[model samples]
Target: MKKLVTLVLFLFILTSTNVVAFANSTPKIPVLLYHVVTQNPSGTYQFSLTDFKNDMAYLKKNGYTPLSLNQYYNILNGTVTAPSRPVLLTFDDSTSDFYTNVYPVLKQYNFKATQFAVTDWLDTNGHLTRAQLQMLSANGIDIANHTIKHQPLTSDWNTQYSAINNANIKLKSITNNAANSVAYPYGNYNSTTMSVLKNLGCQGGFTVSGGLSSSNSNKYELPRIIMANGDSVSVFARKLTTGY
Candidate 1:
């Protein structure tokens, strides 16, 4: 009986050690993608402000740390260590809803986020203006490239290159910060897209593909989970704990 008890204790210790090792080896970072935040959402991509606030509250209460895309890149490159339960919150499209609906909630939590902006859309009606983008950058928000016209990168090489370069230039002019990351327009890209981004010195690229990002993820094709309209608090919890 004494020997049996000793064997069980040894097995428990071994199992616990292996579990810890596995967890350390595989660090899953969930990058959440959001399009627009509004009280009355119009499409599947738009999320209500109420739901967005709830999601933020859950993340804050759950000890999840929000990291900007630049910080995420540093972590991936081993230049920085991540906090426990680190999450990357990314908002695509520089819509006015972000200025009106999202920034206030994020500010309340003192959290940081990345915003991908289309250069041509700025200063237009119902879109984020240059002044707003500059202010967002000053307040810990990273302004990234989302192409000039939000066109799919499956087009010709010149078209793809021009779109990315023009957007980067305009974004830098407005924010005085390098636009080093990109989120593919419509979550769409082709074989030439990555090469174009690389040549332009883009450090990170995001896709709409749903999964947990890791250090081993492709720099130009990093996956992100979409947070859409009507996602409850429970659904948000599951997306963080379990990859889509």
Candidate 2:
């Protein structure tokens, strides 16, 4: 009887240790956000070309793997395992500068990225054109939805649903790939926003919150770290390692 009790305690300890090990091995990835990448920095979200390139070089040299929005979700869904040093590089607004500036550098690094595009902004005022979107989609960049007009989804249900669904339709018409995920405009979203997104069959959502994304994170409020024009390579490195 004494030996049997000892064996039972040993088995319990072993089980607990295995559970702890599995929890510790879970990956915590960082999603970095960007807006405009250009030589001429103007807005708060505008990032300089040199810094942007440096950031990419740092990520590449440090063996960081950039994943698309879909791949990120795959990791969370348990169908796929996360890679070593996984990072989700997300560019918002899908400005013309992304075509003129960011796309070339991303190609040079051979990195995959997600572009959160405002459907209404496309083909107007400095945003990416339909041809540009198609080209990017064909390449490694995954175009996801921001909204129809970059509007915040704090409004009524009808407005939120239309803004998201219409943008999804528009993106499909251009790239033949509807959005798998979405980023809430200005990080504004309520329960209504989530309902609209779920009804549209969205897999996940992103927000402007700064934190590391874990497998257990909320599906509709995954976090992202915003990049600014003045963020240096060192700052970028710190944010990447510590997850803001």
**Positional deviation of residue 129's Cα in model 2 after best superposition, in angstroms:** 0.3
**Model 1 clashing-pair count:** 0
lDDT of 2 at 147: 94
lDDT of 1 by residue, 1-244 (tens): 9999999999999987865554465467999999989989988999989999999999999999999877787667655677879899999989999998999999999999999999999999999999999999999999999999999889889999999999999999999999999899989998799999989999988899898888678999999999989999999999987767
Once fitted onto the true fold, the runs of candidate 2 whose alpha carbons sit more than 4 angstroms away are 1-24
Error of 2 at 231 (Å): 0.6
Best model per lDDT = 1
**Candidate 1 residue-wise lDDT at 171:** 93
TM-scores, all candidates, are 0.89, 0.89
lDDT of 2 at 190: 94
Off by over 4 Å in 1: 1-26
